[model samples]
Target chain A: MHLLSIRDLVVKFRTHDGTVHAVNGVSFDLDEGETLGLVGESGCGKSVTNLAVMRLLPKPAGHIEGGEVVFQGQDLLRLDESEMRDLRGKEIAMIFQDPMTSLNPVLTIEEQMVETIRAHRRVSKSQARARSLELLTMVGIPKPETRLRNYPHQFSGGMRQRVMIAIALALEPKLLIADEPTTALDVTIQAQVLDLLQRLAADLGTAVILITHDLGVVAGMTSRLNVMYAGFVVESASTPDLFARPRHPYTVGLLHSMPRLDAQPGEPLIPIEGVPPDLRRAPVGCPFAPRCAWRLESCWTGMPSLEPIDQTAQIVTTGPNVTHRVACWNPATPDEAVAARPLREGFTPAAAPAEAVA
Target chain B: MSGVTGQPAPGAAVGVASTGTEPGRPLLEITDLRMYFPISSGILISRHVGDVRAVDGVTLAIQKGETVGLVGESGCGKSTVGRTILRLYRPTSGRIVIDGQDITWAEGSTLRAMRRRMQMIFQDPYASLNPRMTAAGIVSEPLEIHGVGSSSERRERVRDLLATVGLDPDYGDRYPHEFSGGQRQRIGVARALALHPDLIVADEPISALDVSIQAQIINLMERLQGEFGLTYLFIAHDLSVVRHISDRIAVMYLGRLVETATSRELYDRPIHPYTVALLSAVPIPDPAIERKRRRIILTGDVPSPSDPPPGCHFHTRCWLRARLGNPERCVVEAPALRELASGHAVACHFAEEVDGSPEQVLQVTGEGMGGSSSRRADDSPTGRVAAAGPGLAT
Candidate 1:
């Protein structure tokens, strides 16, 4: 059974310049202990979807027009503020990218952490401090006992993020939502933090919704990934399967466009043409059709719904199956997937090779 | 070498094939470039405590029409090197020779003339472009500052530049806020190309854009380079993107050049321990490779530039040092950047020994060296002497 299932989530922002459909009919499911990655570009509504799930969207500007976020058999959208507050830290915890801003500058780390622990449970003050210390140590912070009294400013950027992870895992929430958690960090620090988060989540069997723009981070960490483009999951599949055989044109375009370190020298990058559509006017047929290379004539008239591409070949697994699902008018077949390989010698119409600068 | 059609041998001198022309030589050459910002204390009687050595002794040469990538972490001063080379900040000490002219200490109109030859594209397109100015005004401001042409000619040029960067000419009347991040960057590009610069220091031009948009900008830059025959010093933290766009990649750490080699040689066979760790830290996009590969996670954050470590700046977090039983030489002496294989240079005490043994480095790290005494004792002196080869040590 799914731990959290989002169905037909439609979200809009009531801005001064007309209504912006941030998320239109978005749906996905997450099982316990499974890591789900929402991979997309900026303003693709991946973060908005997670925000709607947490009921953390900023005031009257944002609204969930329709949809159901069923979490542990409860519709989060219908829950009251008081009841939702109770479920937030204790049931579902969140960590954001900028730990500096997410954490309080004035409050001591100990006070903030202890407050979180005591809010969920009727624990004594001293007991809460001890628990906070243990949690900090669990996330690999040295000298947690003394570090507790210090403010967030005393810690380095990486250590402060570790503190954020500690606080999120303080109550042992069932689901952990990390939105671009290490985007601000250096590559070395980023690797360390990602390792720590993955290890802690695995040990505790916590479901993780890892949102990031980096396909590399998603490939290494996530078991299942949902590629979002223009506020919709263009493709969803197991990490390995998606890398091996991407069906959606958008997914193919993304994988091809990202210059790979492993690619041969001077390999041409096949960039997708045009920019993301303006959200003020909703897409008539397909949002990605304007940028997609494999758009069919019918794609100009109707939007394609998410449908399984090869259901018969899917194998039953402990978590979600590797069944490829893509929302594309003309998705790539398994054989045609190889055609999406990085350019070797010559350039195609999509990939214009610049003469080597030297 | 004669039989090979398109392949240049690894580490072949990059600019030997160019025909002698006005700007055909190395466009920008720097020798021991350093830029240090002062750290002051006490408001009433502010006294200089120390200096943040942002760009410490960086020496590099960018050939005309070649893109040289400068990559490092955030506080590592890759951006400082670009800014200093552009004369935005006067270097603490070093020489900057651009297009056969020494503009390092040029005064008055000479400096102004030099600025016209070299332009900069900043990382944040949103902040870089003035929000109040129209796209036409933004692109044409440089032309006006240099007094390149008449007002009507500049207006026509602005529209042409906008079209050259893949933006609609009609959109030139719109303000910066009216445009997207990618469009604003195109405007910045058009501005940089306005004066026909010989060298363009693009400081993380695509870092702010989305992944899809990043590709668009990269392709656009590449196209512009082809059409204009431009030279670039691309500074960025993303190693993969840097490698993709650059002909030669230089890895920096703690404001010093750690390694420099051709793009293929650098990625395929990185010698420096810092370079190896950095390359390993980058997670590949393929899950099968990512899971199977061994990663070397550096232990701690980068040290403060104001108070960097004594000897080798990377020694404190060096996995190789610990694996080699905490080499005393690494702790006592700073290694100079020396050529290991042809044009591939590294600043490490054991670059030769560590070649082709990255997996061993990982295994040693995984074994929990703990500064153990059981390492091969004989490996130390040979590494020291080999790295301290003829003319390597200052």
Candidate 2:
């Protein structure tokens, strides 16, 4: 059995404007020791999906309308608040993007970490403090003894993020949901944090759900990857299969849009040209049809379900149970994805429909 | 001048006429620019304890019509350098010369007039734009501040500017809150271009943007540069994006420049150890190359600029220093920015040793550049791919 199974998760947020469908029928599976990446632009429902899984969606406003988050045979959505609270930091932990905002300014590193440990495990203050110190040391905090006494404001951006990791792993959770964990850090510091996360997760045999918009980060850090669009998983595959052969037009556009370090210079980047879609009203068509380069007439009628693109892709996969899948009316061929242009002779780019833009 | 880098090459007259710069002079010349913030103790009778040397002893030259990228991690003063160049923060010492005029000490009308030729595009599009102001008002504010044209004329120009920056002219009436992040940034770009500035100091303009929207802004900037003969000081932390847009790239470490070269030259043949490590650290979006690469992950957080390590500011976290038997000279004498072959400049004591070392971290060879051949490192610490593409090559 899979470690975690999220089936058709549909999360909605009641805004002043309208009910925004934050996540629409997003489903995926996580193995015991897998690292899955969920990548997309802002408002693409990657974070909301994970938030729904953790049962940590904002109070009242955000609601999981329909979903079955089956974790180790128990439906996490059906769990009561008290049970959910017990599982939060122990079975599942989260690391937010900005450490400054996530951590309490008034509390010392010791107080916060010890409190988390004590809340989960029935340990005394000193024992919890010792575990906190050990975790800080494991995450490579210099002089954990003295650093633990320091307030959140005293640590540097990188050090503060390290402290956050230390706190999150204090209970040795089976699953970790890191939302843009290193986005606020610099390249070197990001490298350090990602390396630490990867190494520690491997050592602990922990499954990680790394939510970030950076393609480079997902490419290196994640074994399985999901490309998200406006409230939908547009594509899902193993890291190698996803990069080597992206079938979805949105995925292709993303691959071509980014300026790669190894890309040939002066090669013009083909950016997806349009404003991001509004989630206030759910569209009848594919969310990415407006920006897609390869779209068919059928794309405007209905949203395609996440289905397999290549059956043979799972044979040489890096991670377990990762099949190459995409949700699109007209998927791009490997040649089209690589060249980022039409394979046929008389091909024209897909224009945004008039109503879509307005 | 304590550490002036260079003079412009003789007989370079391409962009002089457009910008009114004298022949053989770069568009922007910075000499030993130092910006230090005072640290205080007591609230009422605060004693100046020390200085947070944000940008200390930096020199650079950007030719007319050139996009010079100043790249470094946070707290390395890349943004401070950009702000100091635009005179946002008055430098504690050194000179800033623009269009052959020394504006380091210029005040009142002179500073205002100098500001006309130079402008800045800030990092955060959301925070940068005034929420209360409409897009038209925000873009037209620069023109209005300079008293450039009549009310009607300014209105017309604002509409034109919006269209020029790829925004619909009709969207001018909407406030910043109404527009998306990408559209908001377009308004910011339009505002910067209102004064017809010769140099635009873009301080992490695209960093706040999404990966897809970033290309639109970069392409627009490139097109504008070509059309208006504009020079740019592109300050950013993303090495890949900086390389994509910049002609010359400068690497900063703890307020001082460690390496500067043409983007092609710097990536292919990095001399400074810090540059190599930085190149290695940036995770590229290619799984094939990522699987084979060996990241030289620097061990520690960057030291605080207020109390930067003596001698070499980077010696505290430098991977090369430890690999080189912990040289005493690195911790005793600060290296000056010395010119190497052609346009390349490096500030390092053991640069020759670095030049001779394996391109363990840097293997991103530019196509058609025959000088440096990229080959797989058989001795990479990480597992290696036999023949992956030469990208994400840490």
Candidate 3:
């Protein structure tokens, strides 16, 4: 059974001019103990999708227009505020992108952790403090006892991120939503943080939904991946299957554009042209049509439903279940002969019209 | 001038002859550059002194039309070196020669003119670009300050600059807040190009943007460089980004240059222990290689700059030092940056003798610095020293 499932989720923000459809008809599922990565560019609605699941979207300005967020056989969207609050810290916890903003500046680390523990459970102050120290040590922070008294400002960026992780793990929540947790960290620190997250998730049997703009990070850490375009999930598949055979043009572009550490210097990086479409006005068809290299005419006129490329064939023949699914009308065939064709390159901007896909 | 004769002060021109061949002269020469800010106590701040040596004794030369990358972790002072070159902050000591002109002491109009030839692209586009100013006004402000052209010409040039950076010319009338992060950064690039600068200092320009947008900006910069014959001083914490754009790469740590070499040389075979550790830490995309790849996890936080280590800035955490037996000299004397190969330079006491292979370095430091004490005896000089390796001072 799926641990969390999102179906046709639509989130919108009411602005001065009009409502902005930040997350439009996005859908995905995470199995028990599975790591799912949500990849997209800025303003692509990846963060909004996760926020919708957490029911943390700002009210008055933002609301979920339509969706069903099913978690452990219960619909989270149907839950009342008080019921959701009870489950929030104990069953589901989220680690935001910026640790500095997420943490309270005035409170000591011990005070913050104890409050979180006390809010969710009836525990003594000393017991709560001891549990907090254990969480801190589990996340790899040095000298947990000494660090408990320190304020957020005293810790370095990396340590602060580790503290955020510790707070997220306080209740041993079944699921964790980490939104670009290591984006601001240095590479070395980033590696350590990722390693810690992977190990803890496996040991504790906690599911994680990792939201990021970096394809390399997604490729490295995620078990399953979702490629998001303007407010929609363009592709979804297992990590190895996605990397081995990407179907959506947007996913292909993303994979090709990243400059990996293993790649030799001076090789030309293939960046997708143009920017993500404005979310204020939902597009009639594929949002990535303007930037996709292999976009067809149908992509601009009508939206494509998420469907299996071939119903008869399984996504991964070796896996226990077929999980790969893409929302592209003309998905690329995963064959060595077809993949061997040279990618189209060097098309001048002047020769091509701005809005035209081909 | 009191203590030194041949060496020049900060921003003064070094008198070293440029080999006289002059095919491509060094556009900027920085020698023994230092920028120190004092940490004080009490209300009146009346103490003897303690200083944070942000940029201490960094020597480098950027040739005309050559892109050089200054790479390091945060707090390493790469940004300070860039700011010092542009004279945004007054340096405490050392020399900065720009276009063969000594602008170290130049003030008022002279300094303003020097600023025209060198411009900076800041890291945070949202914070850097003034929200109050329109795109056109932001780009043309430099021209207006320098009095380079008339109002009409400046407007026309701003349009051209916008086009050059792959932004719509019509968007110039809009405010910075009206655009996305990538568009605002394009405007930042357009503003940087307004002066037709000889050299540009890009300080983590794409680190704030999305990865896909980062690729676009990097590609745009490369295209602009080829078209305008401009040189770039790219400063970033990511080695992959630096390797993609730089001809030569320099690694800095706690305000000092630890290694310098060609992009391929440094990435393929990093000589400095710190550089090796840093490279091993970056997560590669390929799952097979990533699993097999050796990772170096250095222990302990970076020491405060106000009280850096006594000798080498990196000695406290140097993987090579621990592997080759922690020499006493590493704690007493600092090693000078010397040429190991034709163009590669590394500043480590056992640069040549150390087994700098990624696997060896990772094996030594992977468990963190706690294992250093045990390996100290096995790697000591008395144990076994290679005969033909680089000579050790201790």
Candidate 4:
């Protein structure tokens, strides 16, 4: 059974500029103990969908217009404030990108961890402190007892992130949402943090919603992947399968856009031409149609629904019960995408046309 | 001035451009550059506690019409190297020569004249360009300052530069806030090329843009380099991005150069243990390669720059030391940058072992490189010190 299932989520932000359609009808399911990756570029609504699921969207500006986040046979959207608070840290916990901003500088590590522990359970101060130390030690912090007295400012960026992980895993929640947790870190430190996260998630048997823009991180960390483009999941597949064969043009573009460390010298990267669509205006047909190389006539007429490719094929044999889905009308094979190589060199500015001077 | 073992002392080359390349061959040459920010404490009379030695003894030369990529993690002094070369920060010591002219202490009009040949393309476009100024005003400001052209000619040149950078000439009236990240970066590029600079220091030019837009800027830069015959000192932390755009790549760690080689040679055969660990740490996009690759995960965090390790800066987190059973030499003696092959240079005492290069060959080669084999031990700890075998010879 699924651990957390998001259905038809539509998130909108009513800013003074305009009503921005941030997330448009996104739906996905996370199985028990599964590490799911939500990947996209900046302002692509990957974070918005996760925020909507946690009901932590900023008030007065962001709104969950439509959606039902069903977790463990309960509709999280319908839960009252008190009941929601009861489940937030106990059942589902979240860690954000920037550790400096996420952690309070004035508070010591012990205070924050113990407060989180006490808020979720009926534990004494001493008991909570003991558990906090144990949690800190579990996250690989050295000299946990002595380090707990130091404030957040005393810890380095990677150490603070480790503290955040320790606090989130204190209760051993059923689900953990990590939003770009290692983006602010260096590569070596990023590797250490991710290795810690992967091991912790596996040992605790906790499902994780890993949100990041890096495909490399997703490939190494997650079991299943969801590729988001312009507020929608354009493609979904198992990790190995997704890398082996990307069925969506957007996925193919993203893959080719990166300058591969394994690529031959002097090989040029084929970046997706044109910027992402403006969310202030409603999208027509397909949001990626303007930049997609495999755009068809139907792509220009209506948006395609996300559906499994050959439901009866059963071609993916690496993982059990794996499914590959794509929301592209004229999806190109890897060869075809490669054939569409080298997007016209410096094509007209993709954003705006040439201006006529007086 | 210090920490230079293989070459002549940096102080000895003061006021004189180093030889090897002809007088006016390379566009820029930095000899043992150093920039140290002082740390002080107390109220009335502050005492100097220490110094954050950024860009400690970095010597490099960039040929005309070639791109040299400087890459490292944060606080590794890669950005400081770029800033110091442009004279944005006065070097605490060493020489900076541009086209056979030393500008280390150029004052008054000499500094102003030096500015025309060298320009900087900053990392953050949103913060670098003034939001109040129009794109045209920002691009043509250099021409107006140098008094190169009249008002109408400057306007015409601004439009041409805008068009050259793949931006619409009509967008000249738009402010920085009016453009997207990619477009704003183009404006930054246009501004950098305003005076037809001979050298451009692009410090992480495309880092802030989206994945799709980064390619546009990179392609535009490559085209501009071909057209104008410009030299670039591209600084970035991303290894793949640096390898893709650079002719030669230098790896820095804790204010010291660890490795320098042609992009292909470095990627194919990294001799320094730190470079090997850094290359392995980068999670390749391909799942097959990522799963099958051997990762050398280093322990502990980077040491504070102000209190860096005495012998080797990377010794605190060196995976090679652990693999070699905590070598004592790594903690007691420093290594000098020594050439292993034609174009590959590494600054590690045990660089010969990382690539399994035969010890006999390295011994014969190291003798010619001067003092690189000075630390050959009497009592070999690894027990395979001078063992002869047909290993991979570069």
Candidate 5:
């Protein structure tokens, strides 16, 4: 069985403006010690989906309308508040994008780390302090003995993130969810932090869900990824396969939109025109049809289900070797993606309805 | 290199604010610009202990219609250089000659006039725009500030500006909160262009934008630059975006210009070790290329800029210096930004060693090395020298 499986998870926010459909029928599976990447632009439910997994969604507004978060053959969604709280720091750990905000400014590193370890393990304060020091060392902080007494404000941005990591991994959780861990860092420091996260996750045999917007980050770190748009997983595949042969037009547009480092100077970037769909009014049809170049005539009529690109792709395993699936009506071929044109003859979309206009 | 392609700019002689000077002179010239913020201590006494030295010394010249990119990691003072040149902060000492006029100490009316010729595009579109003001009111504020035209004429100009930035003229009635991030940035661009400025200081203009929206803004900026003959001082942390939009790129490290070269030259033959390290750190998007690339992951965080190291600000984390057995010269004296080629300059004692080295992006040590242990060990003589440099062979 997979380490974690999310089946048709739907989440919504009750805002003063109206109901915001943040996550809609999102489902994916993760394996033991596997690394999964969630890539998307802002407002795409990538962070919301992961937040639902930990049951840390804000109360009174964020409602998990429907879903099943199956972890270790247990329905984590059905767990009560106390049971979920015990599992939060012990079995699943999370690293946020802005370490300064996520970390407690008033508490010293020692206090926070010890509290986390002692809360879940029933260990003594001194014992928890020793484990915290060991974790800080593992995460490459200098002079852990002295640094432990330092407050969060004392450390630099990178060091604060390292301390956050050390605290997150204090109990050696089974799964680690790093939501844009390096987005707030400089490139040089970002490189250091990414390397550390990858190495530590490997050493501890921990599954990781790395959520980020940069395609470059996911390419180097995660084995498999799900490309999301408008609260739906538009595409999913192994890292190589996703980059090599992206079947979804939205994925193709995203890849082309980014200005690559290795690309020749003055190379023109083809932007995916038009803004994303509004989820306030629940997404209708394919949310990406307005921006997708490979839209079919029927794409605006209804949403497409996630299906295997090839008819013969087998579901033999649950990890990176899983089957490639796309939630696209008229998918792109390798040649179409290369030339950025519709190779399929019948996919020349008719006039889009005025109701879908941005 | 820029002189050849830069002279074709149409407004070199037609500059409305141009003073008596040679027409061939660059649009913006800054010499030894320094902006040191005072660090005060003791609330009762209010004593100035030291200066933060935000922008210690930066020198550059941007020709008419040339886009000069200033790039660095955050807090490296690239933005401070931009802000200082624009006279936002009173510089500690320097000369800023823009379009043959010295604006370094320009007072009141003169400074206000100088500001009209220079405009700014801020990083965050959300916070930059006034939430309560209408789009037309925001864009026309610059026109009203300068008393450029009548009320009706200013309204007409605002419409044209909005249309020029790809926003609908009809949306001028809407507020900033109603627009998306990209549209709000477009409104910001329109505001910057209202004064018909000769130079635009874009401070991380697209960093807060989404990836797809970033491309849109870049394209719009390029198109507008071509149409208006505008020179740009583009400051950003993203190396790839800077390389794409810039003709000449200047790399800053801890308030100093470490390297300045043409975009192609800097990418191909970077002389400064910091520039090389910065380039290697940017992750490429291709999985195939990433597998083969050996990244030089920097060991530690950038030091506090207030009390930067005496000799070389970057000596603390420099991979090339570590590879060179921790050269004593780098520790004793600061290296000047000396020109090695016609347009390429580097500030390093061992500039020759790093100029064309193939190990520019190659990995120094691929295995696990703790940040503290590696930084400490590199300082000692019994060192595990990161001895992988062809530069070191000589």
Candidate 6:
């Protein structure tokens, strides 16, 4: 059974200029103890989707306009403020992008962690402090006893992020939402943090919603992947399946655009042509139509709903279960019929060489 | 200037060589460059004592139309070196020669003219671009300041430049806030290109953008360099991105260059312990390889730049130093940046031989020998003479 299910979710921001449709009819599910990677560029609403689920969107600016966020058979949207608050830290916790900003600067690490622990639990002060130290040590912060007295500013960026993770995991929430957790960190620190998250989630059996713009990180850490474009999940599939046979033009473009370490030196990096669509005005058709290299005329007139491509039938029917989906009318396949069809009128398939297979 | 093809012809416009005394010289040469900001105490009366020696004695040579990548963790002074070359921050002392001109001491109009030839592309696209101004206005400001042309001519130039950088000319009137991160970065690139600069210092130009967008900017930069014969000092902390674009890569540690070599050389056979650890840490996209790779987890946080370690700046956390029995000499004296092989320079006391193998050469020279017992015992007069090659001391 799905651990968390989001169906036809729509989110809007009430900006001064107008109402912005940040997320439009987006639907996906996270299985129990599974890692779902949400990949998208800025303004693509990957973060907004996570925020809506966490009910952490700012008032008067953001609100869930439509859809069901069913977490373990409970409708989060139906929950009152107090009811949602109880569920937030106890059941579903979130780790924001920047750890420094997320942490309380004035409070000691111990004080902050203890406060979090005591906030949701009926525990004595000493018990809370003891638990805080345990959490600190669990996250791999060195000299936990002495370090607990130090303030947030005393820790490094990586350590501070770990502290945030420690606090988030204090309750061992069923679902952990991490929004670009390692974007600001160095590579080494990023590797450590990612490894820590993966290990912790496995040990705790916690499902993770990892939102990021990095495809490499997603490929490394995630079991399931959702590629978002213009506030909608353009494609969704198992990590390996998506990478192996991406059907959507946007997904293909993203894969091509990445500067792979394995790529030949001086090989031209294929960049998507244009920017993401403006959210203030809802897109008439496909949001990525402007930049799609293999865009069809129909793409500009009407948006395509998520549909399983025919080529994925083999994997989709497998025992482990593969639910590969793409929101594109003209899905590419490695067969003669699809390959023979022109990407664009008067556009030859041979014109754009498939440089790297992988 | 129409259809100029932007590529500087081989040996074209040799107006003035930076090192005129030495024939066939590099276009820009920075030798023993240092920029130190003192940490002072008291408000009423500040006292000078300690210093954050950012960009401490860096030496590099950029040939015409070549892109050199300066990369390191944040606070390693890669950005400082780029800014210092542009005189954004005046170097404490060093020689900066550009086309035979000693720009290190150039002032007033001379410096302003020099500035026209050397421009910078800032990292933060949102912060760098003026929100109030139109994209056209931002791109044309440099042209107007330099008195490149009349109003109409500048407008045409701006349009052409916009087209050159893959932006729509009609969108020139649009504010920076209206553009996406990648588009705004294109505008930044167009502004940098406004002066027709020979050298561009791109300081983490694409770091703010998304991964997909990063490739767009990098590819655009590569294309622009080919079309315009531009020399780039690409400053970035992302090793992978740097490797993708750089002809040569320089690794900085605590404001000093610890390793410098060709991108291929650095990636395949990194000599510096820091470089090795850094390379090892980069997550390979392949899950199979990623799972198999062992990450060299460096212990402890980067030491405060204000109170950098005494001997070797990286000695406190040097993985190789610890493996090499933590020699007392490493704590007493700093290692010289010496060229171990062709185009590969490393700064390490024991950088000579890898794992104590006889095939690896370990030789100390000059003042380096006088300070260390290990070096004195290991060094011969013949070895000292051989190691004292060109640009060895600096």
Give the best candidate by lDDT.
Answer: 5
Q: On residues A1-358, what C-alpha lDDT tens digit does candidate 6 reach at each position?
A: 5789899999999999898989999988777788889998888999999889989898979989999999999989999999999998889999988998999999999889888888899999999999988998898898999999999998999999999999999998999999999998887678678878888998999999999888778777887888998889888888877777778877777777766654566766777666777799877777776666566667766789987776546534111255788898676654312232234447532221232111
* DockQ of candidate 6 compared with the true complex: 0.29
Candidate 5 pairs with clashing backbones: none
Worst 10 contiguous positions by lDDT, candidate 5 chain A: A313-322
lDDT at residue B193 of model 6 (Cα atoms): 86
Residue B111, candidate 1: alpha-carbon lDDT = 92
User: Candidate 1: where is the Cα deviation over 4 Å?
Assistant: A311-320, A340-358, B1-25, B356-358, B369-394
Taking the tens digit of each residue's C-alpha lDDT, what string does model 5 give over B1-394? 1111112122234333343336789989999999999999997899999988889888899998899999998888998898888898888999999988899988888999889878999999999999999999999898788777668777877888898999999999999999999999999999998877889999999999998789899999999898877889999999889988999999999999999999877876667888877876777777765665555667778887899987888998887788778998888899999998889889998887773343333335433322211121121111112233222324
Tens digits of per-residue lDDT for model 3, A39-68: 888788999888888899987898999989
Candidate 2 lDDT over A204-290, as tens digits, reads: 998999999999999888889999999999998888889999999888988988897766668788888986778998767887776
Kindly give the stretch of ten consecutive residues in candidate 2 chain B with the minimal lDDT sum.
B1-10
Better of 3 and 5 by lDDT: 5
What is the lDDT, from 0 to 100, of the residue A268 in candidate 3? 82
Looking at candidate 2, what is the lDDT of residue A101?
97
Instruction: Tell me which residue pairs clash in candidate 3.
Output: B9-B94, B10-B94, B11-B96
DockQ of each: 0.47, 0.56, 0.43, 0.43, 0.54, 0.29
- Name the Cα RMSD for model 1: 7.8
lDDT of each: 0.83, 0.83, 0.79, 0.81, 0.84, 0.79
List, residue by residue over B153-253, the lDDT tens digit for candidate 4.
77877888898988899999999998999999999999988766778999999989888888889988898888777789999988889999999999999
- Return the DockQ of model 3: 0.43
Candidate 2 local lDDT, residue B19? 48
What TM-score is obtained by chain A of candidate 2?
Answer: 0.95
Docking class of 4: acceptable
Candidate 4, residue A324: how far the Cα is off, in Å: 1.2
Model 4, position B332, has a per-residue lDDT of 87
lDDT (Cα, tens digit) per residue for candidate 1, span B20-105: 33555677899999999999999799999999999889999999889999999999999999999989998899999987789889
Q: Please state the CAPRI-style docking class of candidate 2.
A: medium
Per-residue C-alpha lDDT of model 2 across residues B128-241, encoded as one tens digit per residue: 999999999999898778876678778888888898898999999999999888899999999998877889999999888887799999998998888778899999999989
Mind giving the per-residue lDDT tens digits that candidate 1 earns over A1-358? 6789999999999999998989989988888999999999888899999999999998898999998999999999999999999999899999999999999999999999999999999999999999998999898888898999999999999999999999999999999999999999999889889988888899999999999999999988999999998788888888888899899878887888888867767888877777888898776667887676566566665778887886566533226575678888778666556576333345222321132111
